[model samples]
Target chain A: MYIILFVKISDVGENTLIEIIQDLISSSESRPDFRRKENLILGIGDDAAVWKTESGLEISTTDTMVQGVHFSFAYSSWYDIGWRAMASNLSDIAAMGGAPLYALINIGLPIDTDVDNVKDLYKGILAVGDKYSVRIVGGDLVKSHIIFITIVIIGASSQNLMLRSEMKSGDVIAVTGSLGSSAAGLRVLSGALTNNSEMHKSIIDTHLRPTPRIIEGQILAENGIRAAMDISDGLVIDLNRLCNSSGVGAIIHTDKIPTDRRLKSDFSGEEILGWALSGGEDYELLFSGPESIVLSVIPMMPAGATIIGEVSGFNVGRVSVLDPENKPIKLNDKGWDHFKL
Target chain B: MYIILFVKISDVGENTLIEIIQDLISSSESRPDFRRKENLILGIGDDAAVWKTESGLEISTTDTMVQGVHFSFAYSSWYDIGWRAMASNLSDIAAMGGAPLYALINIGLPIDTDVDNVKDLYKGILAVGDKYSVRIVGGDLVKSHIIFITIVIIGASSQNLMLRSEMKSGDVIAVTGSLGSSAAGLRVLSGALTNNSEMHKSIIDTHLRPTPRIIEGQILAENGIRAAMDISDGLVIDLNRLCNSSGVGAIIHTDKIPTDRRLKSDFSGEEILGWALSGGEDYELLFSGPESIVLSVIPMMPAGATIIGEVSGFNVGRVSVLDPENKPIKLNDKGWDHFKL
Candidate 1:
């Protein structure tokens, strides 16, 4: 007689797969950090989950990371992929100057994927959620041809919102931290760079676990700064989007742009500037407001925020950079575009 | 020199794709039905969308449908796919006896997909949202190897929640509507049955566009029927789940199960019973309560809800069907399993 003893995911099916997820959910729920989510009425294992919210405006945003397009197992662990996925969505909440309270994740993976790896990915997600005090409320898992993670974060803010369309002419433009680290790290991961220095290691870490400037964004909103966004696409490209939304223009000074100084030792000045201008996924806060408000808020910034430009009205929907000699330079190269063939 | 003209999505890049999505977003936002969502403070633009919630427990649930797993392009129109995606998530809210208020969608599609089809898909989504008064608040779109749609719905309910773990022994088991219709529809779509009959057409439509028993669920909740869930995974499978959750057992009357009468003409009783017991995806609400309360609430049901059985305590985590002779019959087959090889 022949008998089947061992089990694969296919052998046990979706119910069993969900049972596995239930274990993870329970573990996370029992953690002291997660147990503090008093607003949660129900977590998982029901028709739907429930939570409570106070009387205030709530913020919500969603972001997704496709396996091949966003990360690869060859260069990133499942944990990094999961961590980065949460970070991307959290950054959007941070940009709104809100405190994240809940998160919903939707994951699609091939059936043959190792279940242990999937658990590790969820652990990575919970790690970030624990840090931000965001509860993992509920989500869905489906079979897919390619692996992807989609996260939606719900946050709350009682203060005045920082809208992209609120920037005005003469408002000072500033960024929370040095740029180009993520792009630099990508280059190294892609084999275009061979540097193994400590600085390069930090740059790589920056890409793998980019920090969302939630506190910085909150400071900006609380200090009367009216317009802000997290830098996901490169500076020039995202700034153009901000300008278009606000019906304004910008002129950024190259000398004042806060780029990683370590890049200058190994790369040309133009290359470093190019990365800062068009290399995306920095996950840093960019804000514009009245000069007085922005200047006053700078001292409170963690990374010593630098004023790199001013909102311009020379032409709506136009952006330019100023060189050391004060010559206006137009750059044609925008940041990453996934659909570009 | 070559001039680029008549651009496809791949030719234009992600930014242009976003522009196309923005047009769809604006059109949906401006719709008269959607305009009535008064709590929407900020919709679709900027970093995070904002909305207001009154003091109440909110229901949140997420569901995902992958192209080849939950649906197929060969059998379903983009409109059907979109409608079903929203329906699946809304059904969760219905099962919870809640009114859906806001939704977030995360879609993954190939870059070569036609833009018009994507717009049609959104229109289908909006159609359901309009009917259910669900606001399309925010979403994310990314390129993928295969298509998938994930929807997260946030709903509010001030009534007592219907929990699966709250059922009691001796409570009458009931369903909101007839079962096996969706399974019959799937058979027709799969070419296992001829589709010339009106009954078959209705069955096919049932498979494509399921109507959630929201009113029935609300009535159940209001009538003090504390235990309920949507019958997504067929009667026997879902009842087994309910029994396991409540730590009890049940015995359903086979003759009392309200299956489609039209199926009897083309299929055997066993086959029809098999579908009713194990074919899944009906999206009908199933509930259990004291016989007196259930009978009182039956007149208020929208689709003529039927009592089919009674909760029992024969053994925990077990469910059986009773024949006309009162002989207990064990059923082994569950419903659809996406990961089943």
Candidate 2:
């Protein structure tokens, strides 16, 4: 077989992610052939690049969205794809309590792509940029077999940045909005929409118009709630990650969990429970903080938020699904894994 | 007749660049789909995102080098491609006088790709990263039709970051190294390499390994350089942009221009002059400073460096070339364009 390796020579899609990433990390960065600059404060580390900011503290992050794997323009509008790219990366900044400022988009379009389609994609990107007051300054456009958008967002922060590994024992766990709407939305868009049409409307919207919890992030940081991350890959899986990173465990209460009405009925309490655990695209914040801070912020969640669990010390990472009597039940680890999927 | 407006879609056969970056970026951080944190100083922009140093001042930038467009893996080894990507983006950060610290990479792989090929490519990326003391902390990987490597670099700066739009009138102009070698290399690699094997070594190296001007950026920033940028895009285009942005004009001495030896016999001084003005990938520093500062730095540069030009007040926004007798000589723009060859 004349197969090319990590440089993308697949006739069909490939699935060797970890192996490929390892190779990329193993490469060199030196080149004596060219003159180099020395002002780069940080070239390639951390959640977002930390650069020198003359005005506000600038935190930068880049996200790449590709067709087929990420979304299908077949069912999703060109505008939706564009908006999704900006919104998702924007959330990363918001998670760190930064104000969005500028964005650059590097896009690859297939030759068959229509000009209107390209413009529509930009329209969506610009819409999101306009919403956040982020300017689209520069980017690259190229030809490719598929359509891809690489977005870079630069924002400002004054407070200390939040990291995933800061959750402590006795901290309350909460999430903004409801869970499973987006994961369910994906099902519908993928032509597997199981819920009724009305339910599908809300579900699809949840998936298509995911709202980054920027305000919630600011409030949490302001109130001294430090440990947090967006729950895109199942709440359970993400909570497990946050807990593990912080060296803690979580006890999730079945009744206290938030579920969109679409999920509340179409899926059983247990299935919904499972979905809540394994469903990706929740787009809700799963955060842990001191009880006092939670109390002060309870009234501030505009659409109502849920305190689903608490952080506690555990030898091995574990999630407790409690009954009314608070007994533990086994929850399946069914969250999205790009590799296995 | 529908046609893509960009180039670099051909095959040089090292690794094909895939377009999976689409969903990856949109799904990361936060969006309507996930919870977000709020302390992020920057999400993404410029060479890298800027963040309030968890401790000190820092800056960062990222560039994605796709196969075919950035390098031809056939003539240039995988190691060279990795070296160039690192040098290219780091050059941007270094241009601002930031200290290099970390480098992160996201690699896209094709499933059938060979293990050895992946190893060589990464070794190149690593060689450069380690030389600069930049650690590779995190990255992502996925299957793609072609190979695309996106590199993020973090840097540190104690001084104000450099801006390209800050040049002034009467500032002396200078370049750190010779120009046209890269394009000359391109000429050879693009089937122009006949029997002139001995003469084309520099041309080959110039194309495969244009260095990032890290030291020059620091020196200039430290020495009070308000406006500076590396010569990636051609000199005429880039300089035109600089002068236009700073609201000034510029003049260059044709005899003072530095170039590869190959060009001397093939073209007239004026023709070669045009190449110096436009043929890019020189990876040199084209910077402007006060007359005194420019003269002072002349002694500091190796003989390779030259004072080929100076900022002018003769016109509000134009670049004029002066021949040996100091008379203006009109020349056609000969630099590379993205859409053009």
Candidate 3:
């Protein structure tokens, strides 16, 4: 909290990359969070991690976070990079309604990289790991240009793992937090909202430290929710991915899209709706189930899950957004892409 | 075979390091290696790997290979990188008398890395994985100035994992294969021996892709061999490590160090013995057992295991070499390190 942690991708100096990295990750290895299971035999110091899996089903997922491509070094810290890297993968497992167990990280540092940067990045990685009770096992260290991170997460599903294709026409759609804030945060970072101090902190925080919706994922899945996924590629695109994968369609109301505390309509509801629809980087789980089950879980929304849309098979893949006048407006599909560079 | 397949720590480039890393690992989400067992699934993919273990001991080790520092980039190709990566880890598993079940790889790629280099690296990785029946379950990739690789192997042992320290002063010493070929290959690569055109192919082959003695490790373990380790940091340094680890001493005969058929030397047997003792990268397994059980496996060594020394309790940390008339001579500690850059 004392220091704002953001590194500009463009300015990632190679001269001290390694030492910085070593320093960044050192803290994470030293201290762990509460959610770590007991049998994490070897965390960060060995050739590979050793684990003991109990009876539940083990699920695994890997994701890469690249500088400039995946995130802007503009106002991001090594910790931000580390946090989002693991958060993204954990989000995937959460969407499937699983309890995360372990993670292995690989870091590429540029020459002249300071060992401290490595430790800082790892500090973020370990903070997340500890929060989830996932132990930092074993990993490798090497140097490279433009920092690249790949995170693999292993989790356990108490129930059958949820798949995106299992949703039916009548399921109700819900999300584990508000959207558009992260995109707003990015805009502020790019200097579009350069002077708005209040809006800046709220939005920037959303972008810099997005948390995975692991808890809500469990609530929904344990209660029979079968189709879900993390919303990384704008809500509109992600909803379509889920519906299409499940052979269903959906109709979402723009008026119902959630918002942060300060958005008093400087932009049209439609524009804000579009941000929620096409903007990405919100590691929130989006799930759908029966209307009755959704209502029953509303009061118990696990610190985040907010109802955002409804599942109507008639609108599969083509998400229809109704404005205040209940009129359908066209939305664009723009999400993050590694190839953008 | 014209090019050895591995990126030495010396020849690391700067480029799309992460993409090339994709082919090296298997889809952990695909499924478990077999029917699920009740154990702690500690770590997966992230910054550090984590897991929990109960009623089990932890074993740890690390190794590093550089371009000119540890290998010549000219003869070493990506395949060699991949194979040696797996082979080196598997050798460690064998030394512990454990069957390798899982492996995690960490790779460093420079920005200029090509698709083929990446794929070829994975092919080598996968080939070795298949050979050892190891599931290339998880790993990470990054860009770096030097192409450095670190592989962490995890395996299970039904009995006490073998240690180098268990050898007593009277225990017999043995090696699994001939030495100096890898070193000779390095010598050839350095332009020290250009005229041996007839032996070029064989020597290079010997140096480029040396297989680890896992089967022999099994033989040693099943037949009750106690102290063991792979001869990677040279027989001299590695033997010193084992002795130091087990709090024991050792002495070896000069004429006993294994040598290839094409090898020729004018120096006394003790000098040739020096190269065999301290020249690293031999990758053969060094082990000790009761002289009686050692006799049973004598004929079983296809590459042949030679008795070189006996463990000495009072001299636990000392590695002494005897000349033709049993005269002692000073030796060099020729092991590899990354900072050699």
Candidate 4:
């Protein structure tokens, strides 16, 4: 039998790896539609990337994803990994009511990884970046036994910022678009359920390429919505966090929680509600504001918003969910915690 | 036999981990001398941190260090690891002639790691930040099989920026402070050398806690020096990078290279020279400029400057070293490449 050998990163060395990455980035940056921002003084291949700043508030956030913990290649492609990573950071900026400007990506890969896989990852990152006009300014690459990606994104806000601590007890709690679908989609990927239907494909797409509500977040912030956060670690935990920060509590009407029609048809009522309430990674923006203001901004949200909860003054940090019959619903799980035993 | 139980990160969970980290940061931030910048609109405990910006150029860079690859706890304390990581990014900002303003630290720890070790790491990070007036604005903590730290620093610079591509022929190449001490120190820590004297302690400190030449870099840029980069991957390789970026060559006088006096007292002449030329992690600034401008800035550098080479027009991207007799010296190795086999 003929032997086959695959080139590893160790064979080409770090400098060559950097050159390869630069080449990949150059190709993406050279696209006809890829416009370079005038504020950027220098791009990659320097001691540090440089950019000019306008007089405004800047938002910065960082997120890290590890292999077998945050993601796995068994179902998720490298492209999906990159897209998801960028989307998470983009969602953070959106949650802060900011427009993403630049990003710095740091990746740690096993030396045995194929260089082509890295190119595919960069392509995925560029795809989402192009969608939002976010520029890839600089990044770091190193060798590790296990793969990981840490991304830091810098964005600009128009003075007004939506903060979690701004939530008032009288405010209405609402979320943009549907939830539970991404969690359900992840379940499908993890082999909990299998079907070749179009709905299944849609759910998988939701899990793999969730959209960041940037414009909707900005609209809410501009329309006088003072408090907002992305539902990444499920509504229960994140809402509790917002409540804790604001020294308030919340009450949710379970029946009013938004979920995809397909999700309701495919899963049991309890399962769908559980995923919607506690299964995280939806990337939908949850916000609180006065009833009138919240209603006024509903028309401006592209994904639409559904009011499901109300902030309360009693029992700070407590989130009580009510069923259709108005009885308190008991949930077994709170949300996703990376280090929770 | 006695059995003992230690606290693992999994026992405390991600949320508690965050609270612990916040407490640690709060303690450091509350120091009497720690003055918060007015531009920082919001610090931690938000979806994303917010900071107002002055109208100027911003420099951003990221660096990642793996556990076994970059450092070993046997020789490097958790505090040193944190300080060194920050210093690396600070050096990058310095190389761009920028003043560090904020840092975002991302760390990945094994599930079994002790919580106290992480506190030590943060303490180390805070110490460095305090020294340079760089604020820890935001960060992410994640669980991984292997430990790692990725730091992204954002700095503000005047209109002028020192770039690697700005070097030209006939420029005098100078470096800040002495080199080789860090490498020599590494050897001592690795057990290749044995020493317990005060000189050895100084060398070890040089290897562990390197001083980034931030002020020196700004002085050079203000004095009209254009091309500069930090010697991270050794003088030979870094010089070649500068040469290649500028499409020029360089010639170095080996005897002119600087080394710590204690290093020479402890190591052989050849060993000192070898480490000075090819040993990485010096964190010293290597710059090229007109002879007059270089000389004029030398007095302003806190660590002093030594002219060791000159940019040349011949043999583009090649770096040649000459001995006392002016004969060419051949190096067995170039420099450190993370993925080099």
Please list the Cα RMSD from the true structure of every candidate, rounded to 1 decimal place. Answer: 15.2, 7.6, 12.9, 15.2
Per-residue alpha-carbon lDDT of candidate 4 for residues A14-90, written as tens digits (9 for 90 to 100): 33434543454455445555444445432432212224456766677888999998999999999899889999889
Residue B95 displacement in candidate 1 (angstroms): 0.5
How displaced is residue B228 in candidate 4, in Å?
Answer: 0.5
**Candidate 1, residue B132: lDDT:** 62
TM-score of chain B of each: 0.82, 0.79, 0.77, 0.84
Q: Pick the candidate with the highest TM-score.
A: 4
User: Judged by DockQ relative to the true structure, which candidate is superior, 2 or 3?
Assistant: 2
DockQ, candidate no. 1: 0.14
Q: Per-residue lDDT of A1-341 in model 1, one digit per residue for the tens?
A: 99955443334333333444345334433544432434443233211222446776666788889888788988888888888898888888777777777677778877666655665686667656566666555566676778989888877774567777888999989999998889888887777778688877888888888887878878888889878888888899888878987999998999999988887776788887887888888989888999899889999988669999999887898888899889988786644566544
Cα lDDT tens digits for candidate 3, A226-331: 7778888788877877876777778777777786757553455655666777778877778888878877876677656666667775855667777768898776
State residue A122's C-alpha deviation in candidate 1, in Å. Answer: 1.6
User: Which candidate, 2 or 4, would have the higher TM-score against the true structure?
Assistant: 4
Q: What DockQ results for candidate 4?
A: 0.16
What is the lDDT for B38 in model 1? 48
True contacts kept of each: 0.33, 0.10, 0.04, 0.38
1 or 2, greater by lDDT: 1
Chain A TM per candidate, in order of listing: 0.82, 0.83, 0.80, 0.84
Q: What ranking emerges by lDDT with the best candidate at the front?
A: 4, 1, 2, 3
Cα lDDT tens digits for candidate 1, B1-341: 99945433234332333344345335433544432434443232211222446675666778889888899877789988988888877777777677777777777777666655666577667656666656555566677778889888877764477777777999999998898889888888989976478888888899998887777777788888888888887888788878987999988899999988888887789988888888888889888999999999999998888999999877887887899899987677644555544
Each prediction's total of clashing residue pairs, residues at least 3 apart in sequence or on different chains, is 0, 107, 110, 0
